[model samples]
Target: MTSNDATRQALIVRGGWDGHQPVETTDSMIPFLERNGFAVRVEESTAIYADADYLATVDLILQVNTMSTIEKDEFAGLQAAVLNGTGMAGWHGGIADSYRNNADYLHMIGGQFAHHAGKDPAERTGEQSDNYIPYTVHISELGKTHPITQGIDDFDLVTEQYWVLSDEYNDVLATTTQSVRPWDAWNRPVTAPAIWTRQWGKGRIFVSAPGHRLEIIENPNVRTIIERGLLWAAR
Candidate 1:
């Protein structure tokens, strides 16, 4: 790619826990990426991350792998690429919960998925949906003006609301509050970041906590946030 080039390259490395539907979710984003002038490459393994030469030419990386382990050299390659200005972006468990054993990866992302608050036991149905609840994603004052979230009003959805363990390095855009009930462990309501961005070295990392499945990803607001995030994070 040249300075005057109009097209940029995107690398999509997906595949991990099948529950997150990594393939389908990432597949849906391909056409959108192409339409935005990105030459997309989809790889199923982390092997491509170790290919420094190839990574050098990539302007953006959309990682959809969840709860997977990344090899040391492969992780190093990824870290180096970002440090040198490759943008990284992903959503839900894919970006926030991937590579549990690697603290370095977490350090780069600036947040981790702790758990999804479940409904009261009396209302639980012994299904995954037990964790799904109606919640509102509140836009922060900063978010109201940020390019990714501007003009997007706070929205409500019934889904798995994530409780993320995050640090101050992240620029929080939107948040969801987990209310305290008799059945819950926490004392008071806890507000967790639902959308955030981190500046790592020369790269920008964008994360959205709402996309647990295709339906959630396709939500008009969620889709717009992600689309804008991809372009915002690109090198």
Candidate 2:
């Protein structure tokens, strides 16, 4: 587990749907990664996904691209790199909504963005509305002692608590209850993962679905989680 700063390499791939402010969010995280001793690389295209030579040298990847197309080989190369022991860490759509059509990518990442209550058809399309309800994120019992969620108490935020499509493989660390309301009604309330971790081959995968905006990255608890998650996922 002893890693030298000089040898640890990280790649930041940024560029996709601008609404998510992919580059800005990625920029918000770079200084933190650099301070943690990783030699970080920033790229604007998924084309970097196909560079096997470069992928082979990376220890961790910070993907900030959202809703983008990834070519077959490019996707395969990323999967292979992680399977070979590289780590993958990211937040929100950048990680969960990256490739809509790639199932392998979804399986490896362990979840996908199904919808946020605010984005439901019934709710009017406006960023600031009742649709954006204030909710609290509770750390699961399993997360109480986990390094990522340690010392973090239940916190409330006025943002989209993403309802995700997940699996049994994830070690869910935090979750929130989805309340059924007229504007965004569900048959019943369902608890969904707010943060989680999983593995693929030798790779470590970490995801936090809270930082949809750059401000969310500034949340002390959220920032701490991502910082710790990045280190934990690193090879």
Candidate 3:
């Protein structure tokens, strides 16, 4: 692609649960791309199928969708585009909790938010028992050496601590351990994968489970990790 081609391109898709704050989350990233010379385009719907070739011209794909079902053809177009070298990156439920019925989507993303086994339960009872319960995220062994995590340290946040079921194929960047409560638990302590990167064909995929809201993304460390991850994933 020529400079003109690159200058004319950017693709951003945002939809799904309102709680995840897709609109606010993706809007926050628009200026970043614009500053980097991308002509950012934001889509409020997931109708990426209407222009299947749009991904072909895009320099990067920023998805802020969560827990939404995608049609086969639409997802196939995205899968092919990413595999063919269109960059893919997203954080939290937007990426990890997206397209639950599509195994291919999950495969490309490398993991899914399985359960939160620490303080919050699957079923909330009290006012303070929501999934948005706060906790600190520890930067584990692998984070020290990864480009996306370079200079980043252990950070604290008041967001959902993702308990992800990740494929061993991923290059895990960070992790947080959650201790199981014996009274309500089924197993021993399990370590959760917090951030990861993986390759799909000639393209790249990045997942970060921190941005539950715009405020969560505002954290300097979280923002830095996401900013680096987006660039790293893009071609």
Candidate 4:
């Protein structure tokens, strides 16, 4: 199709840590994108990021990769694509915790996953569930007016609540606080961005720090925000 085609193109690059259920999570959104007029493309690797010619044709990129590495050239191509107006969106560790060693990627994302503070030591079972905790996502006043989160009331969730290191460049839409517990090292409670967006060059980037699993992605509020975010960020 030509660049002027009415059908927008979305590229989904998913696959990394199975703990995040990347495949299932990204697959769940395929129908949503299709129904909204996106011609979707799914790939299991970041190798496609190196294909500048193809990336140029993409209107949006939905990445669900976690803790994986991207080669220098691959990242360069992806960076160039976004700089030229291709939107990028993703959630949780897939976008926040990816490419631990790549500072340039983190800079582009405007945030990085510091860690997920686990539950009370008493509840620890040496399993992934140990990181699950009850928390609230507080929407910012600006978020109330933003298209992606408007009308969405604050909500609670029992899951991996992320503690993120973000920059001033991000427009934080929602945040979650990590409280000070007797077993915790931090002296006081700290709030971190749970949902945010950034404008880079001619492109837009959106991130919601929720979707760790399919069920979480399917949450009505989370789903709505993500769907709107995808559309909002699309070129």
Better of 1 and 3 by lDDT: 1
Off by over 4 Å in 1: 1-6
Local distance difference test, each candidate: 0.93, 0.87, 0.81, 0.93
lDDT of 4: 0.93
What would the per-residue lDDT of candidate 3 be over residues 98-144, giving only the tens digit for each residue?
A: 88989988888898998754353545665423655556677767778
The order by descending TM-score is 4, 1, 2, 3
lDDT of 1 by residue, 108-165 (tens): 9998999898888998989879988999999999999999999999999899999999
Q: Report residue 160 deviation for candidate 4 (angstroms).
A: 0.5
Off by over 4 Å in 4: 1-6
Q: In candidate 1, how many Å is residue 9 off?
A: 0.5
State the lDDT of candidate 2 residue by residue for 134-202, as single tens digits: 788999998999999988999988777789999999999999888886655578888889999998999
lDDT of 4 by residue, 101-120 (tens): 78999999999998898978
Off by over 4 Å in 3: 1-8, 118-129
Clashing residue pairs, candidate 4? none
Error of 1 at 149 (Å): 0.5
Give the candidate number with the greatest TM-score.
4
Order the candidates by lDDT, highest first.
1, 4, 2, 3
Cα lDDT for residue 54, candidate 4: 96
